[model samples]
Target: MTNALVIGASGGIGTALAAALEGQGRAVTRLSRADGLDLRDPDATGRALDALDGPFERILLATGILAPSGRSPEKSLARIDAAAMAEVLAVNTIGTALVLRALPRLLARDGAGKVGVLTARVGSIGDNRLGGWHAYRASKAAANMLIRGAAIELARSHKGVTCVALHPGTVATDFTAGYPAHAKHGPEQAARALLDVLDGLGPDESGGFFDYAGRPVPW
Candidate 1:
């Protein structure tokens, strides 16, 4: 059976991705805070991954946090709070890095499997013109860097593993409800596009960042 691991499986994109993978006949293991597998805790993440009997064919990091109640993404740089910014970085960037650091053994090698992280287009330094969500943007940009660096290292050490960062577009989740309606795509669409990207990815495409439509996203 094709084994898969999905972090943040309680979230919209994560849940969707899990369902899609399962639908394709993969046996998926979901990791979430509720399941006691918090990615923020490296030790816990490592333990959870170790608990799996076999290596995973696919690993997807689909966790993120956006503006909360009364908080707006429209806040000016001067209005940004340090606490909120730290929280954003903690979850979006550090958490992901910790997960990757802890779970390298679960990744399949020799170009037969894939590892993907959900990044944002706003993370693209070259694409950030309207900079408002400083913390989120910076965190995601860091995530992209992490994915790329991991890809390079894995390419040399774990020849079979294909790692890539994916931009799932503006999905209509609690995270994006604050944004304008036109900016949102449904979770299903995002899930389908992400799966397509995964299906098309190969070792040669490793370390690249791509949008929901599988187009290259500038880093």
Candidate 2:
């Protein structure tokens, strides 16, 4: 039986991704803040995954934080609050690192699985034509690096497991609620695309970044 675990599974993208994975006949496990598996807490995350009873065939870290109370994308660099920046980094970058750190134990040593994380196009340093969202951009950039580094290490030790970072485009979610209507995709559409990319992943294709359409995203 193929079991899939989805962290941050309560949000629009996460919930949609979980539903899609379930529809594909994989046993799905949903971890969310409401479920008490806070990604920001490494110990809590490790414990939650360990409690799943078996190794997951696929693990998706879909957690992310964009804006905080009293903070908006409209704010300039000088106005960027340290608290909000730290909060975003903790969830977006550090949280992912924690998950990767726990993977050696959470995954089967036999290695026949994949791990994915939802990154954003904005995280692409080469694609950053317009400069704004300093904290979010930096946090996601760090996430991309972590994903790549983890993928390389996993490839060396766990030959059957593929790890890749994905850009889900601008999805119409609470995280992107501030975005204009023309700049967003429906949750279902984005989720479907992400699943497609994941389904096609192989060990040889690991440590790469791709967009929602499964095309290679330039680093």
Candidate 3:
């Protein structure tokens, strides 16, 4: 059976992905801040990941935040809040970095393991059309760069481990509750799509960014 780890498992897409993995008869380990695996706390995050036994077939870092309390995405440069941007990067970019730093040992060194960092299409500098979410977008862009760099290093150090950033589309979760007019997929659907995309990826596709449909997203 495939062994899988789902970080941020308390969130909508994360919860659905965990369920889907379990439903497929895979052994699943779920981690979340609610369960004390807070990624924002590096010490806690490191300890939790360090305790996990090896060679998971798949690992998903599904944590991200649009904005912090009392703040919203900047519509213009004038609306940028330094504190809020820092908070977004803490949870979205730096938090994922902590997990990425711990992933090499937890993955199958035999070149059979895959790791995915959830990112956003809006993070794509070449694909940005209606740019408004400055902080969130910037955090995701940085996270994508981190994933790409990690993938390159892991390829040399861990052989066949494929690390890529994924976009789950506009998921019908609290994450998208602010934009009711946008097209969205239910968490279950989005989770399944992401898994299917993962199923099709190989080491050759490492360090790339792709959307829920497995289509490449411009970086």
Q: In terms of TM-score, which candidate is strongest?
A: 3
lDDT of 3 by residue, 108-213 (tens): 7775898988999999999998978999999999999999999999999887888999999999998788888998889999999999998899999999999999
Q: Residue 103 of model 3: what lDDT?
A: 82
Please say which candidate is ahead in lDDT: 1 or 3: 3
Clashing residue pairs found in predicted model 1: 109-160, 110-159, 110-160, 111-160
Per-residue lDDT tens digits for candidate 2, residues 1-219, read 589888889999999999999998999989887766776787887777667655888888888887665577524677688788888888889988987887766677786888889988888999988888888888999999999999888877788998899999888988777667547889999999998998898998998899889899877
Q: Model 2 Cα displacement at 182 (Å)? A: 4.1
Candidate 2 lDDT at 78 equals 78
The list of candidate 2 runs beyond 4 A from truth reads none
In model 1, which regions exceed 4 Å deviation? 68-70
**Which runs in model 3 stand beyond 4 Å of their true positions?**
none
What global local distance difference test value does model 1 have? Answer: 0.83
Q: Could you tell me how far off, in angstroms, the CA of residue 120 lies in candidate 2 after the best superposition?
A: 0.5
Give model 1's TM-score versus the native structure. 0.92
TM-score: the better of candidates 1 and 3: 3
Best by lDDT: 3
**Ordered list by lDDT, greatest first:** 3, 2, 1
Clashes in each model (backbone N, CA, C under 3 Å)?
A: 4, 0, 1
TM-score to true structure, per model: 0.92, 0.93, 0.97
